[model samples]
Target: MNQPHHRPDPYTERPWLNPAISPFIQIQGVTKRFGDFTAVNAVDLAIYQGELFALLGGSGCGKTTLLRMLAGFETPTEGRIIIDGLDMTEVPPYERPVNMMFQSYALFPHMNVFNNIAYGLRRDGIKSDELKRRVNDIIDMVELNPLTHRRPHQLSGGQRQRVALARALVKQPKVLLLDEPLAALDKRLREQTQFELMNIQDQLGITFVVVTHDQEEAMTLATRIAVMGAGQFEQVGTPADIYENPQTRFIAGFIGSANLLSGTVQDCQPEKGTDDAPDTSRVQIVTDEGNQLLSVSTDRVVAAGDAVTLAIRPEKISVTLQDSAVSDTADKVPDNAPNTVSNNGSGTVPGYVSGNVPENVLWGTVQEMAYLGRLSTFRIKTDAGPTLEVTAPNQRRVLDNRHLIDWDDRVRLTFSSDSAVLLTR
Candidate 1:
């Protein structure tokens, strides 16, 4: 028998995974303090070459402070900063091999787009011909050729952003530090510019370190993300790694919305495995409110009586009417109603009634509903004394409101055993 050849995934080409490859930028035990206030805690980080890394956090989370340190704007109160193979702890801002794009594009009002981009090259004493070639090449790369003569005041928000980017890139720095680069644009333009930024970064291959509070921006743009909280790194990994397997309760709630329920572990069933493979366990949890949930193939270890939290995303849940016979008076439905149901003749959610409820099922009443064109969000008041949010897509056009899953309807919620994450923190 012949072995099959495996094709590599482009997104999974992680240089950081190879231990022999040295880090392009390294921050070892870096910390910053202002009098009694500690802005950044002692944190260690490694950035690979040509990687688009993001420092993500909310207001006052030390992401900006760390970015400034990398740019040589602020010296660390403790620890060292290394770029390539040199220690740059005390290097001045202008002397470092990095360029920073401020949140406010920072284009000169008196200079047109061309002069704004050429300003840095002129200060470096480049000859006129070489300066013009570099500046025009960058301008063309950013698609700002026709607007080169326009001043900052005459350009729209998106065009001004391109000018700022062109100015930053013309100097040909080894690294680019962007402090909330896309924060000023409106929603649609911001989304569009994110792709443009990615394309330019791919073309240049310069290491980029971005600071942003927007989760979606970081997820869409970064090859890896470092989620910070209160002067410390909460977690650092690829977008999918951080989102799917959050290490803490704060991370589980911060990256996205999760229905967090407090519970106690009822038992654990650890499966046998080889030494090289990760150990797997099936955990049974009973909520404080008397609801039972099961998590399958979880990697976390927990014994009976250990307190834990079960996190389930809203989109992972499936909701359907309990029965077609159920009436306006939801309380009339039997407490021990059958866990399975027929279509009830309503076409709202077809094929949803064909299976029995999974181990992670809840009986609830639809308390609220919001139709937002593509999908509808529902807040279900579970009989277990918790309000669970469920989102369902509107697959077919709604011709009549009568057939829709309305408010106060008795509903059953089910999720796959693997969908629920077990968090012991």
Candidate 2:
């Protein structure tokens, strides 16, 4: 038998699928409003113990509002909040078993690091040797030992952030709520602090609820992400699940860059194969653009003529020069690949039609090009379909312009059927 891999990043899979633990925090049908406007809708969620959970969304999307409610700064206009098996809806912010770290870091300008950290310890009535030990322990935990005697203004932005973190953690609350905790730091510092924050969360085993609009931050910091839209959660899953298998068009577009093509289903062959590898329903969709055909494997049973959408990420599609004249049949692609499409099919995509129309091939002229350091991104304007954006890594250093896919160059884009997701929405 194979040994299981140690230290899985997101902890194997979604918490719902794991049978070992129950929810440590529960928000059952929670909603909040300011005047007539609803900031948070009726949302049901469960967060397990020691989880680095993130509430992600765009501005005015209710993520910060939800964090405020969780921290007892704002009461839910409807529903209840429970943490560590106790109802916290009406509990005052001071009494709640949670500490909030604001976006500003909110350090005391006059007080030095040690005093700031000790403020909370003193408030909790811990005195003398015990207080000093607790403050020292937390200061060391956040790596702010050297700055213990320095004032907030004397510290760098990152050190101030660490001090704020130390202050929040010194209390050792059951849950920590951070509102855009890393927003103020520079990109490089933010990236470095991401792992540092993750490590502290892991060592302390404290449940962390972070709110961020940055997708990469959420992906890197949290075990689970709840994508909020219009005051409600659209989907909750691990980073892979949210990126690879988004349930809605908004999610596909929001989580990452996606190419969306509208189409209509021509037919579906439901459950047709064998015992060992059961055949999933094969859906053949004709693009509304009138020149494309795509097939995908889906679990849903839908009738012909139903409207559908084909969603694929840029990296999933293969881009190449047109001289190969590769065929686009099912056999052309590897068995492991799905929904194969190509650019060699001259008439198949938008602009031109010819006698030898290759299947799954799209012919387009590069309208724009951007040579990003690690990747080259191209925007193609075709004669028949919508413009497509394709990105390919610069594996080899390009010394000459000839190696690059220049503007207005006729290039071919190919992709597997299974690589594209069929969405009814």
Candidate 3:
């Protein structure tokens, strides 16, 4: 469970800008409202070209509304949107070089695959021969040559999705918008189609933006993700960046399962005998961690006595039984000072409590166990009052801990402070 404490300090500046790279699409203070309800708040965003980006959030979070604004289906009440150096504030959907694929796959049941792929071209008054050539090329690109003559009902769900994609790409727009493109397929087909979509996006080199509520799907498909909440972007970065370096509690909790512990900073010890003193902090988060608190880096104007939240991911934690092998023992606090020697382990750090195991372990009872073939998930209810979720992989059937961690059995969970993240809220 998380412990809470209080301190006095004004909130610092929020860091959401990434000015390291060139931006292809820019949105400044964009907002949308209807009646007395606001669907989208004032938000700033930057999206690069030739990138597969995802807007991820739960329903009513305005992800779909943001996408519709980009596609010109809805106009923003304030701010400006620039795509490929053109101001798109008032540009109509048809006039803009953008195409959107609806979530429903809105294909005509009466039209064959060829005609479906050529519908946009024919509506735009393209020449017959060129339209046929482009339609056939896209049909072959999607690997739908065998089903080119089949209507929407004649093909499988996956094939029909491909046909819809082919039609969307037939116009060769500068940017493509996909709205929950894989939400209709079954789990197995959706997994397979994700890879196919990546391959096609790379091969075509068109900028693609997908809106989804599925966290795993966004992590798998997007080069970068914008996690939305309350109609605003909480954080935007690559899948790894969003997972590892979340800027807020919302991002930390929304992106993955994180353990957020709130406390007051007791001390700030900088790295001694190092040139990088200003970049790191040896801050004590709470009255825990045995005076060897984790180091965190930030320029958020924090002092020794301040309120903050330390966020840590579940997988980063290491669990062991109480009687298991003892690892570290170097940091034995004597009186008021910390131990002089560092517990830098080659593989396993030396024990901290000298000859005894440290008191960092949390005792818990396994409340539930779910075996998912190669790995097992154990939900343990700790004495701290929060249920901790732990995933243990099953390598050797004989060595499986699943048998040891039965319901109501006592277990100990421990993890290093370095694996834990420190946050402000």
Best by TM-score: 1
lDDT of 2 at 294: 66
**Model 2 TM-score relative to the real fold:** 0.88
lDDT of 3 by residue, 208-230 (tens): 99999999999999988999998
Q: Name the regions of candidate 1 deviating beyond 4 angstroms.
A: 1-6, 9-12, 272-277, 324-357
lDDT of 2 by residue, 1-425 (tens): 13346535334445666777678899999999899999999999999888899999999999999999999989999999999999999999989889988899888888999999998879878899999999999987888877899999999999999999999999999999999999999999999999998999989989999999999999999998999999999999889889988888999999989988888887686867666555678677777874466666776667899998889898877676544434533223322332223447333432112233332456567889898889998887654566888899988788966656778876677665557787876
Write down the lDDT that model 2 would get: 0.82
- lDDT (Cα atoms) of all candidates against the true structure: 0.84, 0.82, 0.75
Per-model TM-score on C-alpha atoms: 0.89, 0.88, 0.82
lDDT per residue (tens digit) for residues 41-96 in model 1: 99999998899999999999999999999999999999999998889999998889
How far in Å is the alpha carbon of 189 misplaced in model 2? 0.3
Q: Distance (Å) between predicted and true CA of 390, model 3?
A: 2.3
CA lDDT for candidate 1: 0.84
Best by lDDT: 1
